[model samples]
Each structure stands twice: as C-alpha cells, then as structure tokens.
Target: MENTKKKRYVLVSKTVLVERELWTRVRVAAAIEGETISGLVEKALCQYLERQAEKYGP
Candidate 1:
C-alpha cells in the first residue's frame, strides 16, 4: 500500500523578472533559507496583502 504522507504537491509554475541586483538578492536569500524563489515570493505577496489590509481596513 502507498503511504499517503509520501504524496507531493504538483507545483504550478510561473515566471517574473526583477532588476539584476534584486534578483541576486532573492536567489541568495532563498538559498540561505532553503526555500524556492517561488516560496519566498508567495510569502512576500501574503505579507503585502496583510499590510494593505491594515492600511485600508473595512
């Protein structure tokens, strides 16, 4: 029987570009944190949403 815990997420892919220095910084930070660039970007976007919500609460 297959172990359910062995299943993996099939990540959907996308691409975006940044200035060279920022790209370098992101790559270094991702590597240091053992996270993919996508993971870092996703977390950044969630944080951005939180800040916006705080600024414009309903």
Candidate 2:
C-alpha cells in the first residue's frame, strides 16, 4: 500500500533574552537528552499552552 501520511513543516524565528543560568540549564538538558535546544523549547511551550488551555478552555 502507498504511504498515506503527510509530511508536516513549521518554520519559526524569534529572538529572546533568557537568564544565563536558565540558558545553561536548558543547554545541558538538551545535550543529555540528545535533542536540539529548539526542540526542547518547543516541547516546553507546547506543554505550557496545553495547561493554560485546560484551565481557560480551548
């Protein structure tokens, strides 16, 4: 059977300042988890949004 799944792509660019200590912690966690910093940040943001949505609805 032919593949039915569709590829997805999302592109975003932004610049934000973070405390040095927090940045260091995120970098270390990403390295230990074998994930890119961007991925880690995106995962965190998604989870945060989910929590907010649960509390506020949609």
Candidate 3:
C-alpha cells in the first residue's frame, strides 16, 4: 500500500551501485554533517564551483 501523503519537494533522484563499505562511509559522513547524502554532495560541489570561479574571476 502506497501512502498518499505529500512530500516537501523532490531533491535528487539517481541510481548508483557502490560497494557496501563505501556506502557505509558516505552514510556516516552525512550523519556527522547532519545532512542527507544528497545535501552533502550538493554543498560540496557548489563550494568547489565557487572556489573555481574566484580563481578564474575577471
């Protein structure tokens, strides 16, 4: 039975096949940062982009 409850929003939807140990490490890192794995990855990527922009700024 599927619940008809509404969700807040759709963030990320993807599929990846990773090793159990690597998945565990990702989960632990997300927990320590108080974030979902998606959130952690998104934030990390955004920060990296900003740093790159600064380095290449006009």
Candidate 4:
C-alpha cells in the first residue's frame, strides 16, 4: 500500500469594509450564484494573488 499526506490550511476570520452599494451588489450576486460572500471574496483574492505572483515573483 502507498501512503499519502493531505495538505492542511488554516482559515482565519477577517473584517473588511466595503461601500454600501458594492456590498449590496455582492450580496445579491452571492445569493444568485448560491455562494457565500466570504467564498466569493476568497476566490477573487486568490485569483488576484496568483496573477500578481505570475507577473512578479511568487
């Protein structure tokens, strides 16, 4: 049998302030997409970081 190890990540809570209009839009989009605001934000952030890393250095 082969052994495998799973990678673990730690998630931490964070507070972010956004404009009222943008926040409302995000809320509506999240509901329509069936995704949480936190999840949407996390995905966007990760994509942004990946682009930046590719452009610059990881």
Local distance difference test scores for all models? 0.76, 0.80, 0.77, 0.75
Q: Write the per-residue lDDT of candidate 2 for residues 1-58, one digit (tens) a residue.
A: 9999754433334557665666778889999989999999889999999999999997
Give the candidate order by descending TM-score.
2, 1, 4, 3
Model 2 regions lying over 4 Å from their true place: 1-14
Name every residue pair that clashes in candidate 3.
none
TM-score of model 3 vs. true structure: 0.55
lDDT of 1: 0.76
Candidate 1 structure quality by residue, lDDT tens digits, 1-58: 8767643333234445455667778889999999998899899999999999999994
lDDT of predicted model 3: 0.77
Error in Å for residue 31 of model 2: 1.1
The residue-level lDDT of candidate 1 at 21 comes to: 65
Model 3 C-alpha lDDT per residue in residues 1-58, reported as the tens digit of each score:
9999654433234565565666677779999999999898789899999999999994
Give the candidate number with the greatest TM-score.
2
Cα deviation of 8 in candidate 2 (Å)? 37
Per-residue lDDT over 1-58 for candidate 4, one digit per residue giving the tens place of the 0 to 100 score: 7668554433334555565667778779889889998898788799999999999996
